[model samples]
Target: MNVRQIDPKQRGFLIVNSHPAGSAETVRRMWEQIPCRTDGSGPVVLLLGHSAGYGLATLLTGLRRHGIRGVGVAFEGAETERRTATAGWYRTAAADSLAQGAGHDFVFVNTDAFSKAGKHEVLALVEERFGKVDHLIYSLAAPRRTDPETGTVYHSVIKPLGEPYEAPALDFSGDVPKVGRVYLEPADDEERHATEQVMGGADWRLWVEALAGRGLLADGFTTVALTYIGSDLTAPIYRQGTIGGAKENLEQTAADLAAVLGDGGRAYTAVAGAAVTQASSAIPSIALYTAFLRTVLGDGFRTTVEQAGELWDQLTGAVPLVLDEQGRIRLDGWELDGQVQDRVRELWADPEAGLERARAGADWFMEQIRELYGWGVDGVDYGRPVETTVPWPTPGVSHA
Candidate 1:
């Protein structure tokens, strides 16, 4: 794994192809030079909610080197909601011109995955083009979800369980960033129920059933949904709060759906570690914890891409997939190590010490947020006119 950060236009957020050693272009060259098999032994992975999420990065870093087909779904929001017009524009560029620059078999579905029409579009593409999807990875996080049956929409909230919870938060969203103890109260009954209904496995089941009905799933297929369970500090807001109930629902849904997919198919909900994500930064306590963790732990921070690569290795390892007592894939095991936890707890117990140590941590975390949108990458010359679009390479010019 490359620990040193490369240019964003080269390998980071911007991800423009520079045709360097070990780059996607180099990988393609090796494939052709070695006279390798055109068809690889890898499975076809379909990712939903990829553009601004982790699933895409996870799978891409793991599978892109192999000559496997890839499919993704993401929407560009009008004003930076989930996918923005700019997001669609640039992501489409990366998918075509950079990441899949070698003319690899890749497809990008730019639409709303939550809607029936969008789901149908996904199904139609798979049936017509790919035929069978080997793995289905769902990593979507939307603010609101409309009940498929009742048609009543429910929005998710990120508040504590009982009394108001106070935690030190770094607000870089303001003109000047500052850390302060912000207070947030618990959610009402409606908010709690709605959060569970939406973020839970209800949607996962719906998506799987849809694909299964159409025979789009490959035999011996495995599906996985991402979840999170942090340290005890954020329990009231994350694990024990409304989102926690929703997560419990998600785990249960995964179990039920896995059983339903009994034809050699498996489904699992894996707990992911806290890192800099568009969604995590919105959550009150998680952001603070991540900053503090980074402060104490050095560049021990692993982005979605690194986490996914680690996960892929475990999934395709020599032995069977291991699970915790609760039958859950404990991907966050490293993050919750006893030693790391003890140190973080020690700092949490003393805010004076915490702030003193984590003074630069929150600021560093904020810098990571900039990388998400291609701002903080090196070697990206803004002085030059930006090339915002490109048709995918093919018979036109193979980076291969």
Candidate 2:
């Protein structure tokens, strides 16, 4: 083990190091926040891309609230002698430790979830140990994906499809962060197709098919892909962009997956609200939008953990599973509320001025960014020497 005092180095939206102590504490806080635990029994879940964002939230919510035991597949860098592990890597380790202490079965696979070998490895594990996967959560997000069968690499772009988009964007790449206007060129047919191939539902569908073909999926199997549909303010660069084209394909894929699941099974896209996630932070105007959102939503803003818990309740019949007119699960209702949008519009009209009024929100947004990388959590000893090469608890099928 290598021990050193590590401090985060930020370049743009990226944080180079993660604090293990703080990461563990963040996991603990989320775990402890659950109002109550169930009978210590629930579904055997299989989560893909479950190391951060909505994926991580779903994993924790399942483990703590419903007593789920399962496998997670994600692409993460293990801690090395020269550098610290990624935030998700540390977060997974913390989750494994906690789950073990609580007597729950959880395993992590550190490999490329987008590859064929990765899929086969997970299938073999399920066949050998976990006989049935009751719930499959597809939370994978990536900028590029290579088709295992064809060797064709597709890269996703965030440009609008038909017309150019111009918006005020937030920047965290410098000592003094500021908001500035950004212009994006439109995507051509090929680029649109590539983006859809990378971020869309094809891979999601492939995973489900593979599991079902091997008889690994349980009866009445449930699957959901986490997604986002920002308000009209971000429609040009988001909901109406190339990414939107991908999301539309994803939603359609969900329907197709449901058909494959047959009568008893279910599959849908769970549209979640905007928050400060690594993926969202990389988007052009999201940082600005979320800062204002946090300000306007105030106490109403729901964290990914909270949203995951609600989704779990609906999935387990603990509460009503609400669906919108499109037959997709709607978790972004609060973010899209008429009153909420009205207030957000007041701020969106002029972000520079809006940010001044929403300073609290802006500050909260910045803190969330720090917290994601395990740097800004409360009660963590930054001065203490911490282990950077902490081993993953269970070695899954793939070698990290």
Q: Quote the positional error of residue 176 for candidate 1 in Å.
A: 6.2
- For model 1, the stretches where C-alpha displacement exceeds 4 angstroms are 1-41, 65-67, 78-84, 173-177, 317-319, 383-400
Q: In model 2, which range of ten residues has the least summed lDDT?
A: 391-400
Off by over 4 Å in 2: 173-176, 395-400
Number of colliding residue pairs in each model: 3, 0
TM-scores of the candidates are 0.82, 0.96
**Candidate 2 lDDT, 201-315, residue by residue in tens:** 9899889989988988888889999999989999999999999999999999998888877887999999998878888888889888888888888888988889999899989
Cα lDDT for residue 43, candidate 1: 64
lDDT: worst 10-residue window of model 1: 18-27
lDDT of 1 by residue, 1-400 (tens): 1222223332221233221222222223222333223343366777777655466565455445444565677765332222223343344445545444444666777777877888888788777767888888888888888876677888988876776777766555455455567788888888888888778888888899999999887888888888899998778778988889999999999889888988678888877787776677778767668777887678676656556655665555524566887777776766788888888888777755675788688678766665555554455553444433333223222223
Best by TM-score: 2
Best by lDDT: 2
Q: What is the C-alpha lDDT of each candidate?
A: 0.66, 0.86
lDDT of 2: 0.86
